[model samples]
Target: MEAKEIIEEKQELALALPLPSTIAVAINGKKKSKYVVRWALEKFVPEGLHMFKMLHVRPKITSVPTPMGNSIPLSQVRDDVAAAYLEEMGWQTSEMLLPYKTMFLHKKVQVDVVVIESDDVAKAIAEEIAKALSISLLLELHLVACFQGSAASYSHFHSPSLPMQRFQALSTINRTLLHTRTGSIETNSSRRQSLDIREEESFMSPCPSNSDIGYAPSQVSSARSFLTDDQSWISDQASTSDAFTESSSGSQVNINFELEKLRVELRHVRGIYAMAQSENIDAARKLNDLSKRRLEEADKLKEIKLKEEEARELARKEKEKYEAAKREAEYARECAEKEALQRKEAEIKALHDVKEKEKLENALVGPVQSYQEFTWEEIVSATSSFSENLQIGKGAHGTVYRCNLHHTTAAVKVLHSKEGHITKEFQQELDVLSKIRHPHLLLLLGACSDHGCLVYEYMENGSLEERLLQKYNTAPIPWFERYRIAWEVASTLVFLHNSKPKSIIHRDLKPANILLDHNLVSKIGDVGLSTMLNLDSSICNINTGPVGTLCYIDPEYQRTGLVSPKSDVYAFGMVVLQLLTAKPAIALAHLVETAVQDDQLMEILDPMAGQWPMKETKELALLGLGCLELRRRDRPDLKDEVLPALERLKDVADRSRDSAPKVQLAPPNHFVCPILKDVMHDPCVAADGYTYDRRAIEKWVEENDNSPMTNLALPNKNLIPNYTLLSAIMEWKSQSNQ
Candidate 1:
């Protein structure tokens, strides 16, 4: 009763439990089974277990021979054979259990293999399929095969049951219990009657008749008899069998309850699977969308990089262009600067040339001309534009050039007149030279009025200062020639001072101003400091300031600023001292006067002036001393004392020259002076048919008023030029130099 009560409770519990909404049905492809599918469809699928997926695992197909004796491919054979077998096995087309491929409703859902047989190949294939699908593998028996399909075939297929399999087993067990209950009751009643008879025989006899034995045997046969006649044993056997039936019934009830619980759990699990599958699909979609966006972003980044590279390339090209343009501009600027510098240099050179030409022109022309005007151009052309080769001499005033004008050779004096005072002095010199004309004086040939220049008759022998002071490579002038030069210069001074209306005071009378002609005759030139004094009493007393060369300037004239004819006499005295000593005028001036006063005339005499007459030299020295007196009034008068004394000295020199024995080694006649019989530095011709030293003839002309050779009264004191003799002398000199 307890067992029945427990069974009733379990049956109630099974009815109360929820049913599974899904089940897995595995069919056997080898058996061509439709029963497995049908049984699952009728039993579990109809109970609203909608997740009924049929897993029909086909056997691996083997190569089969065709009618043509060619082998058919295994895959084609399996498809055709499987479909045909299922159809022959009475599988309805309308009851279409979805194919195995369609069973994968959720890719993530775990698959369980309900293997119908324990075939290793099938198990391996199922494992491989599980691995390929990335799902779990569960080896299981086909539960429906155990129930509906031939039980004899599945008799060895023992496996743990699923909820559906266990529920089917319980139903089979419940049906068997109905038939076995009547048998169990009949056995129980017979066992009880045997026990009552055994108890009544205990009071009767121990021994029995044949009828008694027969009754015992019938009762024993009525009881489900055992080998022993123990009453306890019969009762224990009946109770034991009853307990076994009750335990079996109880076990079936518990299994049914558990199966119903598993169904409910399976339903819940299915719902979970469905929800998980839906979420997985959404997540996959979102992941796909994100991948697309990433692709697009990558493409955009690639485009941006390309643009940046293009921009960089363009900038680089622009920079190169800018650099190229800069280089071009710099080159152009440098070229322009070089060109400008070249042009500026050209302009400066041109300006310098113009200035030099202008200077040359001014130096060749005189500012004031009282004679024939010669164009500066003609003078430049004549002197080859004052080439350095044509330059004969240079002085404080200007340079002298030997130029040939209109076939007449002359000395051109170009004055320096850059300063205003020097320019005025130039004009004054021109005026003075233009007015003065004497045989013992320089002759002005022509002039250029615009430029400060004077053209004079060229003197071949240079000056008395050059001959006396410069003793290089030349025979010294004899005492007679020295005397002759002194006499000529004295007479020239007389000529200047004793002019007609007014005496011309030559303030600067030095040896340099005393020039020599080709005949070595002294002629006064460069009267740049000469000024005229009127013979009238008022003008005769005029006091002019000191103006002369420093060493030759009279001491009294310098002190008192009194310039007179006596001033010329003082300068002439300095020149005489220079000729006696053959020294510079300034050097002699400092010591000569003191020497002469101390009676040291012979001590200071130039040894170059050979065979000097002591008496005559002393006389000349004393006369120079009188002229250099400190007071102008105490100075010797040129006409009364200086002139007459010089004339007597000239006569003495000539007589001495005549008395001197002729040396066999005398110079050639062309080189010798006709009067002095010395090598003439300055040779000039007289109208009386003689080429005499210029100083000798001028002195002779002044004192005797006639030529020495002819002893005739001359028509004019003008000397004719002896070019032939002069040329011969120059040629001889050049040969001698070589």
Candidate 2:
């Protein structure tokens, strides 16, 4: 059923109940509860403690209103906020009334709290007085009782017209206040109407319908009450007291006739009222328990707060200690840095003192050598007065010149206006290169730093990239030639990797640094970007700064800031893949369009080298893929991969040789063979005439050809016995004998 129907049915059930003399407490007044209780005790003595049972009879009101026309369900809002506040305060409390039923409707309602306990003695006495007045006036002042619906009807009237009008307007302002403030008036009006309907019906038909079929109504058809005591009814006042017995009518029946009639009904009313009052007392006891529990909880909460505050203070002290330690460390670091600066300054001064001593020594020694120096006239004659054609190049550091010095062809790098030695970087490069010698590396012939010049063996060919990538040159280095070039470059790296005083890592290995000889062989040209690792120290250790170009950088090294020989391996793999594909490293990325799944590897190989047997090629590609694995540990050692790859190439060559056709063989001799003796006189051995070649026929003829002239006549008889075997044997001999 819908909510309204369920509610109506519940109200109807309450209405049909046979309650004894009932007293209603209207929640519309401003009287204090304790004072009201005292008044109720004195006035409605019959109702007594049963007043508390009215807690169950909450009513639904439309709305509440304020005098200024503002409206709200103020009672409900208050209850909700109060509930939340109570919960926040850790109160173990429950609302006895539903939120919907606990509101009062009033045009100018200002409600704080509402309570409906069973009417006590004072209220019950007032109700009796009203009933007696009605009987005397012969005016039927209906005391509407029982539950009524929202709309006013004759049955169980709940609200008087004057209060309802005020409530309707008040509900427009505040709905909650209306229901809470006027709950009793609303309930009483509706309840009394319901009682009147039941009373009228009880007289008209004491027994409700029995069908013509003679079936009686069910026993539960009528409303029922629970009280069963009959002796509790008050006897007639005249019969109990003689003072009221003075009348000729013998006042036993007349003086308290009304009271005697009430005594019967009031017996049950008084019981219900007593029960309600007991409930109120129990509620007061429970409220006391709740307040006690709340006090205990508050003490516990205060202890927890004290502990939390103590923990926060401890944490603050620790933080302060940590800050102090951090500051002390920073001060210590500053002191150390200051000491280092002072030490470096001292070393610089000592070196300056040594330089002054060396200059004094050179001053004494060079005095005689100064006499052999060329005069301005001789210098002018040698250089043809600074000819423009002699200037070979200009740079940020200096000018380079092509010159014939002591009848030797050389390129001279001269500083533009040097009052000193070359730049520290240039001098460092010179020092390193002068000590090193390799056929493929640049050779430093001499240095004349006093004159700011460096003389070296000149390279006629430009960089390898210039030769390969130049547009006009159009030099198509064949795949084998490119492989040879890559091998030469790899050999150079291998030498560097194993160099003494430790291996030097080329931090920037690229095509631009690769120079080519006249034969197009690769030679590593630059040592400026090289780093020498200490041989005694761990190999392939990380350095602080990031090294290598974006395209050539190992992703693992980039992510982890670690450098290793494997990092070089990754870069070399990139260069190798680049050379193999004949594409620059930037373009090499395009080939790796997707992940290198085993099956898709062929797609990543150089498309220029038309499909070769890919089993080993794929294996090689996988080696490159391993170098590119995100983890540094998975990449193979360069020597391990290179040696196997060379072996694979050798195997490919061997297989190609085996697949070639064999030369034709000379015809075998039939005269010596018993199987072929009959055909010995044949001029040629052909496919149609020979039963088998010398290799197979010799065995066959030896077993079957048993004639006396076995050497001269091969077996000419047919092996299978046919219907015309003799003719076949004759034809075989004629064809074979030559």
Candidate that scores best on TM-score: 1
Write down the TM-score of every candidate. 0.40, 0.31
TM-score of 1: 0.40
Evaluated against the true structure, the overall lDDT of model 1 is 0.63
Off by over 4 Å in 2: 1-424, 447-460, 472-474, 539-544, 556-562, 587-590, 593-620, 643-738
lDDT of 2 by residue, 21-110 (tens): 322333222223223323333333433323221212122332345479975563655676655644533321124322212322121122
RMSD to the native, candidate 1?
41.7
lDDT of each: 0.63, 0.47
* Cα lDDT of model 1 by residue, 102-147, tens digit: 3333332233433322334344334443433211112224432233
User: Alpha carbon lDDT of residue 155, candidate 1?
Assistant: 29
Give candidate 1's error at residue 377 in angstroms: 0.7
Clashes of each: 17, 64
TM-score of 2: 0.31
